[model samples]
Target: MRLVVFDVDGTLVDSQADILASMVDAFAAVGLDAPARQDILGIVGLSLPVAMEALVADADHARMVEAYKGSYAKLRLSKGASSSPLYPGARAALDRLQAQDDILLGVATGKSKRGLDGLIEAHGLNGMFVTRQVADFHPSKPHPSMLRAALEESGVETADAVMIGDTSFDARMAHAAGMPFLGVGWGYHAPSQLDGARAILNDFSELDDALNALWTD
Candidate 1:
């Protein structure tokens, strides 16, 4: 059996508006200016603490993290699943992939447990993932801790698993875990930055062929 792990933020859903809004609120709450939009996008796959630190290393990261979560929750409450709608064809792609008996679906994300669960529930993706790795239990992306834990829990070797994500962080983490990496073109990072990805999928519609190309090699 093969394991397919996905990154949530940019890969599965387009949560950029909520992310940017909450980030602005978080920084404002702490009397700090938020980073530029591009800069914020650059850290999409990182945990709150890590992202906060990257934006403003000297700021109150703990407070900012809490503020970000609070703001995000409010936004989610007000907007519902539309705030982070699955990209066009995302659900269809996921359904197709999940239907494969030999493929096990999992998620490795920088989102917290509550955040991940809420998104999954709102998007009607409950129970779709076999292994859920959240930032609550891992160091951060590019660390390989989350991917390693997912592999161990699934009883799958690194070679039989692939990490699908939208950032260099995901590619780096897959490399660290000795796993193959697949990148999404519509995510925050440019396709050029997805170093070491076996393939870069332009859209969910191309998912099957991209995976086939990667595994066929």
Candidate 2:
């Protein structure tokens, strides 16, 4: 079977507003200013502690992580899926892929297990993924642990699996795992940053076409 692994935050959904807001709150809680928007976005695929360090080398990462989690939880409860809505055409593309018998869906994300579960529940995406890998159990992105776990869980070969995401982190992780990659242009990273991607799509509407091209070639 062919495996399709997706990244959460900036890939399937657009969570920039909520992520930035929570990050701002987290930095404030730690008595510091948050980095610029682009700088924050650059760290989207990293674990919370790593992201915190990247944003502030000497800041208290633990406090910021908790503060961000607390703030995000509150935001999720108050705003629900509105805080991180799926991209346009995302549902359609997902439904179409799920209908296919030869493909298995999976997720490799930097989100905590609770956060990923919340997003799944909020978006009614329960049972959509055959495997879900999160930061709670694995190293941050650009490491192969999560992708390797997804492959092991799905029982798919590297040659038949493609990691779809918006960040350089995803591309590097896929490479490290010996898997192919497809980049999303609308994600936090620029296409220029997506080095070694087989193809990049401007939107979800081209997802299947891109996947097909990647696999058939």
Candidate 3:
């Protein structure tokens, strides 16, 4: 089976507003200056601790992570369900891919299992993924641990899998895992930052054709 692994944050869902707001709350809670939005988005796909480290520098990593999670959760509760909306055409692309008999969908994301689960439920994406790898179980992006686990779980070879994400971390992770990378332009990082992607998708409408091109032998 051919496997398609997706990154969650900036790839599938446009959670940038909530992410940035929660990050500001997290830093403020710890009496630290919030990092710039660009800087925060730069570390989008890494594990929270690593991302926090890059943003906060000398702060208590554990505390910052907790604060961030709490602040984010509070924001979600207070702001209603509109915090993260799927990018345009994301659901359509997923539906199209899911209709294919030979394709097995999976998720390799920096989000915790609970976070991913909430997203899936909130977005009505139940049963769309055959494999799910999250930050709770593996190293952050560019490490290949999550990708490797997803491939093994889905019984797909690296050569038969493609990593779809918006960050350089995602491209590097796919490279390390020996899988092709497809970058989405609407996500956190710039298209230029997604080095090694077979092609950077400029529009979600182009996703089906891009996936076909990458998955073709």
Candidate 4:
């Protein structure tokens, strides 16, 4: 079976507004100035502690992480998950891929298992992915541990797997794991930053075509 692994935030879902807002609140709660929006967006695919470290110097990393999680949860409760919507055509692409018996879906994300679980349930995507790798169980993006675990759990070869995401972190992780990477242009990082991607897709409509080409070629 061909394995298709996806990244969560900024890739499958556009959670920029909520992420940035919560980050701002997290920093504020800790009596610190928040990083710029662009700075926060640049680190979207990283685990919270690592991202927090980059955003705040010499602060209590664990406390910031907890504060960020609490702030994010509170924001979600108030604004609802509606603030983070699936990009146009995302569902269609997933549907088409899921219908193919040879294509097995998986997720390798920096989100916690709880966070990823909520997202899948919120989107009614239960049981769609055969493997779920989260930050809770592995090192952050670009470390290749998550992708490695995903491949091992799914029993899929690197040559038969492809990583789809929207950031350089994802591309780097895929490359490090010896998996082909396909990047989406609509996410956090710039298309230019996706240097190692086999192809940079402009829209979800192009996903299948790109995947097909990757597998065939």
Q: How do all models score by TM-score?
A: 0.98, 0.99, 0.96, 0.97
Query: Where does candidate 3 stray beyond 4 Å?
Result: none
Q: Residues 1-217, candidate 3, lDDT per residue (tens digit)? A: 8999999989898999988988887888788889888999999889999999877678888888888888777766675547788888889989999999999999999988877887787788999999999999998888999999998899998888999999999999999998999998889899998998899888779988887777674
Q: For model 4, how does the per-residue alpha-carbon lDDT over 15-115 read when each residue is reduced to its tens digit?
A: 99889988887787778988888999999999999999888778888888888788777766666558578888988888999999898999998888877
Cα-based RMSD of candidate 1: 0.8
Error of 1 at 42 (Å): 0.6
How does residue 92 of candidate 4 score in lDDT?
89
* Model 3, backbone clash pairs (residues 3+ apart or across chains), number: 0
Clashing pairs in 1: none
- By TM-score, the better pick of 1 and 4 is 1
lDDT of residue 15 for candidate 3: 91
**Ranking of all candidate structures by their TM-score, best first:** 2, 1, 4, 3
What's the CA error at residue 105 for candidate 2, in Å? Answer: 0.4
Superior candidate under TM-score, 3 versus 4 = 4
- Cα RMSDs, all models: 0.8, 0.7, 1.1, 1.0
Residue 175 lDDT, candidate 3, scale 0-100: 92
lDDT of candidate 2 over 1-217, digit per residue (tens): 9999999989999999989999999999889988999999999999999999889988778999999999998989899999899999998999999999999999999999999999999999999999999999999999999999998999998898999999999999999999999999999999999999999998888999898888878
Alpha carbon lDDT of each predicted model: 0.93, 0.93, 0.88, 0.88
Higher-ranked by lDDT: 1 or 3? 1
